[model samples]
Target: MAKYNDKELAETSKFLSFVLRHKPEAIGIVLDREGWADIDKLILCAQKAGKRLTRALLDIVVATSDKKRFSYSSDGTCIRAVQGHLTSQVAIGFIEKTPPQFLYHGTASRFLDEIKNKG
Candidate 1:
């Protein structure tokens, strides 16, 4: 396994966020319906996009993320974001639940009116 520094890890993590959460197509790869992508293919496609990615770095990133943003498949052959996916592409099986009667939201005062209106 290749050793990587904090900067390398952070940069790779951001790149992962871009491709995995937002635009897999940016690297000429497609995520599955559940948003999982083949880890090997992800590494290759990221290299083609001028980003350096390796299985080792990927492992570190997934292990170190403070927000628990990414997840590996049970078999460890695939990966996906835990949430924050574009619904058009990734149909993660989220459980449906009714909204609570009252909910507290945190936001800047400037956005309160909009939130009230939308809510």
Candidate 2:
């Protein structure tokens, strides 16, 4: 296995996040409102970013990520971020079987209320 220093890891993580933020319309995967970009898109984006994205590299990054950064289907066709990593004040809904309609975070209610009152 290849080992990376702290700087390299941080750069890779940031790059991963950036790739996940955009959707690859060519591949027909749409990123959710939250920053969950598709896995295929991520690979392509990595390639564009000059990173040699391979199955092994992908597996290594996912395995070593401390924040649980990425999530993918068993088949590897679909991918997204695990959620809640982008913003400390936000909540992420990760229940694949039965996802919540609205994430129930303490700050969310207050934020929603403020939005509603403004409207």
Q: Model 2's lDDT to the true fold?
A: 0.61
Give the Cα-based TM-score of candidate 1 against the true structure.
0.78
- Across residues 1-119, which tens digit of lDDT does each residue of candidate 2 receive? 76666676677666566555433343343565544555667677667656766555666677788988886777776566665344332245545687679865455665887776885
lDDT of 1 at 95: 83
Per candidate, the number of residue pairs that clash is 0, 0
Off by over 4 Å in 2: 1-3, 22-41, 84-119
- lDDT winner among the candidates? 1
Give the top-scoring candidate (TM-score).
Answer: 1
Tens digits of per-residue lDDT for model 1 on 1-119?
A: 68899999889888888888898888888988899999999999888878888898899999999998899999999999888886368988888999999977788999989878996
